[model samples]
Target: MAAPSHGLTAPLSGKLKNVNFRIGFVELGKKKKRVFVKCCSSGFNGSGICIEKCENWKFDSRKINHSYRVKVQASSSTMPFASPKSRFVSKQEQFFPRCTPRNSGPQSHDAPPKRDTGIANEKEWGIDMSNENINESGTNEDGSTWYRKSGEDIGENGYRCRWTKMGGQSHDGASEWKEMWWEKSDWTGYKELGVEKSGRNAEGDSWLETWQEVIHQDEWSNLARIERSAQKQAKSGTENAGWYENWSEKYDAKGWTEKGAHKYGRLNEQSWWEKWGEQYDGRGSVLKWTDKWAESELGTKWGDKWEERFFGGIGSRQGETWHASPSSERWSRTWGEEHFGNGKVHKYGKSTTGESWDMVVDEKTYYEAEPHYGWADVVGDSSQLFSIQPRELPPGVYPNIDFGSSMPPDDEPPPNR
Candidate 1:
């Protein structure tokens, strides 16, 4: 449970107990330290892994004496399908880890940004960004966790970690080898549920002081929501309009700080997914809102915002709030969501290419993309011109729409944000 030495708290901690069953996601929300979550299981083989509970405590700057308060989201069946008699529950669909960062923050800037410009920044917490093949691995001598510090760049290393455990006494549990940018690699040994004593032991190694075995779950239970600090009220309670110039991963001009759900079939009789976030621009006039749902049957809303970094990148500090490049780029890309002041509500933003988008809040329309098609554009909605859904945008969309050439460079792929 050693945390990163910055403002960010540990977003997640998962150890790959079974290779076929990886922890899907663990993340901190947009409203600073107030909101966070850690989901488990890859759903690869119908295996059920979950974070039945959540609790947190703060260590003094000196890193001593953390007071933890664990809340069980569901007492029974919280970590279901790990029972000794558990059977393989398979479906045609596969559930990936639910740990994708959305860049939906506050919106600012009286004018839109130049979306045509390009940038890139990858969120692979613990892998070599430069040399995907060259990785630096480390194990928690005392615990069940292991880490791979990226050798690709100067400041890339273990920022976040995820874990999972096998269930049932019929077997000695399971172990696995992990290897995903945000995923754990290689299982060393087997363990049950509940990982206690996450703190480092003498000689400096985190130990899983204790683990709880899975109690068979006959019926699904609701994942109890862990209460947290107060959140900032911005953009109808959204973080902010999260899009910025280039919104790309390659141009991480500012060292910034930092998922989805599924497989939780009808926890309490509903199977649906919801995600919402916001972002702002430099002038504090632009804004973006996103309200997306997966199954669409349930009417509950999910909350999160776009981020500069992530769970491990949480505490990263910003040296410059705004930095403009020689090209058409705005340094405000790393600013916080509340940095903008546009008081508009725009929903259903489509990631034109999974990064930039077109928005309309309070009759003002905004668009962001690379220079190829005019980065930022703004116009009063007096004509009700932007009333169409993003899907309805004209085929050429914004005109001169580049179909993208021979695939973007390896480093410049469209972002999940």
Candidate 2:
């Protein structure tokens, strides 16, 4: 019944670039370099966005197993999809050319990697794998301030640490300073959230991820990703056992922004393909960002995409920050997005930080400014000491005012500050 060509002629080699073709098939990707065409083994059903390649038809020749016929060979990096309802068959390969499962039952090219029910799959992949015990510091107030705790429920959810010492040294010597840890794991109705706590400062700048939110309705919390290795079967030569996420981000308030891709190589012969690294937020800040990589089969040069933009607070705090530096020649894979505007982009999740706000402790106010005398007279009762503190200097500059309120009674003179 071969109908609907609409081009009257010339479909990909040259002319015939638009219109209704009686209505049917046109989705493509990549034009100048070849290989576009969304659904065309002779079927034809396209959409668009494939600026190179593709002149008339090329995406390995087509036919991705409607039920049988599994041809797909740009060399066979792989693209296997079979399902008796799918116990698990969505296994794609990489480097091009390896997918070959014409329905054989139990499903196995080599088999082995797929185990569940282990520490509940290591807390369903949030992975702490359980096992933590840290205890040493004891004394409180009288012993120069100290504390220590372990796991299984310390400061409420688990893990607690507090340390403070002066003259004798403990701030950097390590007496155990400000530390916290939390845990959670529940199943039935489901609840498996994760928390990461980090605070370091013995040297320069220190502070790391204290939050993580997965946009909710949580499909096990997006499986919480971050899987590095261990899970490779096809006999372990490495195929379904590694970490490879290409363009992975499913934005959904229900609007579903859309992001899902997978292109492997080696069964036949393409090479690399990546597109993971996206941190975009709108009203809450973190404007837009992307970290990309390419080299499936086009020319030879690996691709790159490091974008950054922040008109306002990207998630707030210190504001804006999204970097993805990785072009020393692909440098393994590629990653981008740094801090923008600076507020800190929720720091890691949730958002907000003026120390946590809500502190209305009026009346203890004390100001101290000596050198440039740049004005520090909010006063709250140091017994009215102002030798020559008439105020009026802004040269060298030194500012450290702590006004918990209460000390402004120098009799009508606390206005300039």
Candidate 3:
């Protein structure tokens, strides 16, 4: 039939520019089946290879399609020659397979609708539609809208929506919306279309609600004054009360005086000198003076007879006796005598009282008199020999004086007599 469709019999070969032209076949119900060759490629227009040059050729029935059907089968050894046919087309004539079908089955109701991916379309996707008044009616370059509600003219530059009063009232009057920019014009008036404005005031008013009216200057000033007055009154009440007094009293109480003679006397006195008056003989007394009369009087007041006592007008005690010198006498002396060689007049001088006045010498003249023979000088020297050159005496002259042996030897004569 139709020459058994010789198209299946030829083993296509050439440069094999497209693998779609290559194909293969297998016979049914036979072990030793025949081989058929047709457009030997995997897809239309030779998209892939059907048989590789180095691989063992095997008939694969699964790849067979209606367009490349098998008729007569040929053995692998039969290298059939192909004749020219008009089926081949140029490379540009090929068409790619379509990926998506025009119509899919009914879409599930749960599937979300596709949304526009562009940034401009995002506002339509459930964005907040509530109007917002930024300053006054103004449009950004991108067509975004802004508006304002209260206050003065929207500042300058890009500052759009602001407020102003009908009259030139300074921060205190009815307010109307005003638009502002670097340059002013009559087109500044516009409508405020938005939700309530939100922000905080300088005085800490939060923006939870819209401001119905501008804050009055007098109200603000009065509130400031009330706050300042409250603060000042609180400060003065605490500071001017008895707080400092109690503090000072407690602090000063550390030196509080107790009731006693010593305490009262100390308080009444101005200094240590005044505390004891002139009673104390210690150096701390104020009445102390270098004048001789005052010191003498002071000594007398203390039961001292110093004026008639020591040569320097000071008194002293010896044992139980209080010895004193007369006021006119600077020094006083006692007299005594001793005799040797049977108390004969030749041996010692006899006093008018006959009490053996060998010699009566006081401490001052003992050395000048040069008395001898049992005459005991006050300072114990029988050789009461005063000398103008006193330093030339022998070493023992002062220590070894014969106070007991009070007579010259009969064999000795008076010195230089």
Candidate 4:
């Protein structure tokens, strides 16, 4: 026996020997090294068979001192090397040269396939043994990994499946392309239960009904009744007194003084002055004798008082006297006769035929007349007098008066001015 050469071994029968071999410490360079061996046969004329070989045989520090060994046995020459039995096994054992054994173990007949040991069990490794058979749960199109309820099929994409649950819950788990579960036949029952507990349907019907009832009972009825009453009062023309009374109440609450009532009497005086001043042309000078003389002649009546205040004592001494009759015709009056020398006056004169005695005076003369007139009469006359005044006054009186500066050539003056 060749002392069982290392890791290489052979079976014998005077034919090529069947042997197991492993490479060990076959040094190639100072740093680069490898080890390789395989099952082979030794025969005449350098005949050797290689089988079950290691891939990329190399040597490292851990395996550099390791060795390969072989074994063989001599046998009769009647068995040829080409025989199938001789190729596989022999009757005797023999050893090969240049090999040694590192440890004692039964010689392996086959080598494991070359593969990455870490990922050997992965699905991508082309090994069907590692594939998982997952049963999806739920009835949805997405093939997710879960035990599906009965009557369900794994969806084509494996993300979902179609299934039915016990309690009539139809699991159509595709909510926005995602899987979900819900009760099918119990939807109406669920709604009714919700209505019984929360007093509403899923569509919010009872809530809307409650809101509508509130609006009808509280807002709509009250507001409609108030609006109807307001409309009736408006049509009947009875709102004026009520409106004024309410306005008066509001004004009183806000601390607004009554028309002629003021603690200092200043508001009354100011209002009276405003009433009189508004009618007078401030540019014309006052005359001393007119207001007093007119008051005497006119018997201190309300009309005469307003006239006195209006013209600031109208008279001839101030300047010219322009009088406008009720007919709106302008006439230059005898200054002394029509207006007192002070610029205020109440002139009573009949027409040229003395048929009717009518009063004529300037706007200033009217202001002096208001104090003696009844409040109603004064208000009425004031309105009428204001109506007669030229709608467009000189800018000296009202800065904002439009004087047709920007009007087109063909445009007529505004009507009824």
Model 4 residue runs over 4 Å out of place are: 1-277, 280-312, 315-337, 342-346, 351-417
lDDT score at residue 311, model 2, on the 0-100 scale: 35
TM-score of each: 0.20, 0.21, 0.10, 0.12
Candidate 4 structure quality by residue, lDDT tens digits, 1-417: 223223422322232234343344444444433333333433211011222222222223333354323322223232224356545442211111111232211121111111111111111111111012323333222221122123323222111222222111112321111111111111111100000000111121110000000000112112110000000000111121110000000011111111110011011112111111112122333212211111122222111222222244444322233334445455433322355544444445433323434454554433232222222332232221122211223344422323366444466743211
Against the true structure, candidate 4 has what lDDT? 0.23
| Candidate 2 off by > 4 Å | 1-242, 246-269, 273-286, 295-299, 304-417
lDDT score for candidate 1 against the true structure? 0.23
Arranged by TM-score with the best first, the candidates are 2, 1, 4, 3
- Report lDDT per candidate: 0.23, 0.26, 0.21, 0.23
**20-98 per-residue lDDT for model 3 (tens digits):** 3344443443322345334332221111112232222344343244343334334523322232331242111121111
Better of 1 and 2 by lDDT: 2
lDDT, residue 348, model 3? 28
> How many Å off is the CA of 279 in candidate 4?
3.7
Hey, what RMSD does candidate 1 come out at? 25.7
